[model samples]
Target: MMPRRLILAGAVALGAAAAFAAFQPSPVAAREAVVYKNPQCGCCKGWATYLQRNGYKVTVIDVEDIEGIKRRLQVPDNLHSCHTAMIDGYVVEGHVPVEAIDKLLTKRPNFTGIASPGMPSGSPGMDGPKEDNVVKAFGPGGIRVFGTY
Candidate 1:
């Protein structure tokens, strides 16, 4: 027969494994983020910090010319931001909310990515209030109302 302590330890280990398995995020779920912005831009830094605070793993790249990056990526003029980022395969522009990006990744929507448009107030880097900003998602076609937050 097994010792009581050994039986308890085995039970605990099994329970812990079950919990970890149950709590694991889906493979397709989005978790990490990467931001590309001009090295001199303070707002871009603030935005990266914001993403970090919200449980995102952010990689920041200081670029010489954000416009060049934007043009190379083919981001539309109206969906422009001070900085541009690529997370997973989608292009995230401006101070887009992390939650929106989460949804986009989970759903794997048929679009390019989310854009807040021209550094609107209350965005990630641009601070004010959640209500003060309106972020939109864009695609090859045009802008679509993804969400306000």
Candidate 2:
């Protein structure tokens, strides 16, 4: 039989490994994010860069009519932003935080998508100090607060 001390040490190591894994980003291959923005938008590029830093495999496509993509995605007019992204079959609008994105992916809520709404200051792509943002989930059911950051 294994020594009692060895058993205890092994258990501790296993627990530590599990906890570390939980904090790491989920499978990267599953986190492909496609961002669509107007050709002239630099803020949109900044937002995409932020997503890349947070473990998303980001692909950016510059289009002439950003509104066309928004409309095609069925994003609400009120929740519109400078850029839009699609990840795991969900639409992410604006400079939404990674925390909210994590929640959306984890919960898999039935909704059109989540949005920070408008070009809010301090959003991932925007300049200025970090500001509290009201993230909303909008769909056929209507809009509701998802989280605040």
Candidate 3:
């Protein structure tokens, strides 16, 4: 028969092993993004680079008619920007930052997508100092604040 001390030691070892397994972090899934932009747009490329840097698998499609793509996506005209991106069924427009994207993905709000409106300086890809980087979410419920950089 196993001694009491031996049984206690085995139990402790099993507890430690279980604890280690529980604490181990799980692998995160990589997100895929498809960006549609004008063929001649440089800032759009910059935005794609930003998303890639943030662990997003970016696929950029340069189209001659970006406005038509936005229209088909049902993005509000007021939220129009230089580029549009589709990620996990969400439409990301303009120069939106990564933090806003993270929040949008976490919250999983019932919105069509989020937009940063015009190309503001200091956004994810735009040049100049980043300031007042505000993003809005538009859907059947209308537009509302999404995030700020």
Candidate 4:
């Protein structure tokens, strides 16, 4: 017959293994995305490049008038930025981080989408060592805390 101590140790080991297995990294990959920007803005292009570097399949569309696109997508004025994107049925505006975008895709927020407002110096495409940058997530209703860095 097995000893009590041995049985207890085996049970603990099995429980730990199960926990580890449950917390294992997902094998699923991120989905592709599409971005829209003004045709004359080079910064928007840079932002698209940034997304591409970080494992996102980005499609860039340069439009003559961004407002038409914005109105079509119901993007609020406060959340407006240099560029806009759609990923997994959510809008991504301006220099929102790849991680935040990933979270948006994962959580699937029931709203307009995320935005960074104007061109903040430390934003994703506008990355710099400066601390003057601010990012905000917005919807048709109002704004939400996105991040500072």
TM-score of each: 0.77, 0.80, 0.82, 0.73
Candidate 3, 143: how far from true, in Å? 0.6
lDDT of 3 by residue, 23-79 (tens): 988687779999999999999999999999999999999999999999999999999
Question: Cα RMSD (Å) per model?
Answer: 4.2, 6.4, 4.3, 6.6
Q: Highest lDDT among the candidates is held by which one?
A: 3
Best by TM-score: 3
Per-residue accuracy of model 1 over 30-144 as CA lDDT, tens digit each: 3688788998999999999988888778899998988998988778898898999888899999888888888988898888888888877777777666555577878876888
Q: What clash pairs does model 2 have?
A: none
Tell me the tens digit of each residue's lDDT in model 2 across 1-149.
Answer: 99999999999999999999999875655489999998899999999999998988999999998899999999999999899999999999999999999999999999989999887788888998878899999998999999998
Winner of 2 and 4 under TM-score:
2
Instruction: Give the candidate order by descending lDDT.
Output: 3, 2, 1, 4
Candidate 1 residue-wise lDDT at 3: 100
Error of 2 at 88 (Å): 0.3
After superposition, the stretches of candidate 3 with alpha carbons farther than 4 Å from their true spots are 1-26
RMSD in angstroms between candidate 3 and the native structure over all alpha carbons: 4.3
The per-model lDDT (C-alpha) reads: 0.84, 0.92, 0.93, 0.79
TM-score of 3: 0.82
lDDT of 4 by residue, 1-149 (tens): 99999999999999999999999986866567898999888888888888889988888888888888887887788778888888878888788878878777777766678777788776677756655445666665677776665
The per-prediction tally of clashing pairs is: 0, 0, 1, 0
For model 4, give the 10-residue run with minimal summed lDDT.
127-136
